[model samples]
Target: MTMEIGLNLFSVFKELNEDYFGTLEKVAEMGYKNLELITVNFSTCERYTDTFSLPVIMKKFEDLGLKAFSAHEGVAPGSVIIDADWDRIIEENAELGCQSIVFPMAFISGREDTLQTAEHLNLIGKKCKEAGLSFYYHNHAHEFRRIGETSLFDLLAENTDPSLVKFELDLVWVMRGGYDPLTLLEKLGERCDMVHQKDLGMHVNPVNLFTATPQGTNLDTMKIYTEFVKPNDFVNLGTGIVNFQETYQKLRQLGYIRYAIVENEGQLGIKFTSIESDLKVMEKYVQGL
Candidate 1:
């Protein structure tokens, strides 16, 4: 029931461009055993070290004692869509030594869009499974928008085949989306084997974003509001309102999850110390796990 703590490279994404090897070394020195790599350009399928080949990147990972646990396949021009070249994508990630392929974010306006997205994820998951890798969908607040009585997230979950399409739950987003993180995790059950651990600040305006916006706003419009979110809205783990200790302990009891990756977005800069603090707070929270 123990879980390994790791860092989502997006925490220091910009640092990678300035000094890829150095940044990774610092992360490894910070005691991160795993990393969730971010895709720089989904158009060319470019990652952090675009100039270097996959083998070279793999060597760096081995040298630094960091495992490429998963990657964020973002939504951009020429991104990994339903019609993309799955064979090539799977082959590359498998070669890079990734255990899972995670689609970090998606934008859907309604139930039809949600269902169609689920189908797309299922197909991608099927290919990943065939290639011996798991496929997961990461969530954001937009997913919690309603399509009638059910949230788009629930509709998408209902439509996707559990065996094929899994989930990488993001705790902060669950709270921002107006759902209790624990309740959603309980509902996801075994379908979620990983999570993004970010804290919700005490002063984060309209804590439940759904409450501020119109009840029936579509995801596309909701995305605009999120883009306007201020960087100061996020704070260090323990300083925020999120109950990481309780959440991590519950995940341990669930007994299926193995990795809890800390993600710090829009808070990178001289704030690398904040990420370090976040890790320490998480370590304290899951002391027994």
Candidate 2:
């Protein structure tokens, strides 16, 4: 069977104006089958949640036939976790019929603390598993930072129970970090469940992992022409550097038949035109897959 392709809702966060209604509707319009809810940037108290309590939003997803398979939330500010609404997210994800919950690392400090990150995920996974949910990290380039003998991904994967903790691999960031993307995929094994895919043409300047920028390049507004997504050069699917064909081949070889999320992380500004550009290009790709 062909692998499932999805859109990471982060892109919508920009152009949709943080309006949940517009975001959901636009996702359906784009013909996405999967969605990963993100930390809202709205000023509305209920909507601006790192702690989710959005049943109406979840219902809308179901109503529109968008399966919210995963979601992203922060390490409860100050605390390593959402001590208050932790149960709520688990139960709601179960309610919305989502399969996994994704926790994002906001800082290098958080990324470097391998033991704590693993323990946090392991603990959350155990709890969620009981509710028929799984816990995973959404990897960025930072997670690949090496301390001694292994990358943080290695330590967290090793420490977390294979049955519980999984991963949502972000491809551009992984490549930007200077590690072979396939190597991390291979090392991660079954822990791999989701992926962030975008292309970046060859970045001309020195690389910056945190900023996803290269020297000599104006990241705020990148003009595209080539197809060599360099380290830090993420763009819409066909408009940038990644070779989706080869990436898809590798994924098929390794049995990754789940969601391939287009994390068009607002590199410059939130523009729906980029998303439309992606959909137009990726539609052909997804159909072939």
Candidate 3:
């Protein structure tokens, strides 16, 4: 369970409560030693500003004797969403001292051109490698969706140059996809670099039939995601659903020394104290496992 715990500041993402410093302080208080940050201000597609907030924010972590090991960078919404000026994004990331650039995203349809995705990723990775920065992909459950007995993600992974595209494991989502996270991790081997320690409580909701239906023709919620995990985003580690203790134990047994980032996506809308309680529970459980 104790595998380099870090925090993603993008979680409590609202303009009103942009308490980046307070969030960092809270994470530091809870024994987290690393942080993953997001940089750039996206006012528009044609005209975006590089706030360079990461350098100053990263120093705050350094001041706390913590490492801002990885960053999410300018890639957003979709893992396969290739930026037109990918080099610019990479350059900005290098400027912030981001050791790794993580493409943590939901896979987009028609973006299933694995060859193109691989080319884009490989191109970026080559640059990052040359610049002494690593690159990775963080998965959501949709990455496991298949076409002709092979997943689009698998196709992308298999086709990509190993030296270029490393994986940033998101264990909970992997498990939710009905595949054992470790099995997939081992499948990729050393191409796997970092990890996202999002534990999906204890309940596996049986592939969720309702979420499988078309959006707008919906029966239930109108959350961020068109379908899948947006509804269940509130479930904290080892609590409502996923067996985090056993999962962490298995991960350790497999010799995966990656960061297990605790990301409470959309859970911030709830009681803050309750969220803190869940975090404590996760911390304790991870330590003992």
Q: Give the winner by TM-score.
A: 1
User: Taking the tens digit of each residue's C-alpha lDDT, what string does model 2 give over 79-111?
Assistant: 656363778778766777678888865343334
Instruction: List the candidate numbers ranked by TM-score, top first.
Output: 1, 2, 3
Q: What's the true lDDT of residue 69 in model 1?
A: 81
Task: Give RMSD (Å) of candidate 1 vs. truth.
Answer: 2.5
lDDT for each residue of candidate 3 in 9-30, tens digit (9 for 90 to 100): 5554432145546666766676
Please, what are the lDDT tens digits per residue for candidate 1 over residues 72-175?
76565334378665677678778888899888877775787778889899889999999999999999887887767888899889999999999999988887
Relative to the true structure, candidate 3 reaches a TM of 0.79
Candidate 1, residue 219: the lDDT equals 30
Q: Between the candidate structures 1 and 3, which one is better when assessed by TM-score? A: 1
lDDT (CA) per prediction: 0.79, 0.67, 0.62
Against the true structure, candidate 1 reaches a TM-score of 0.91
Flag regions of model 2 displaced more than 4 Å.
42-55, 76-78, 82-84, 106-112, 204-233, 267-270
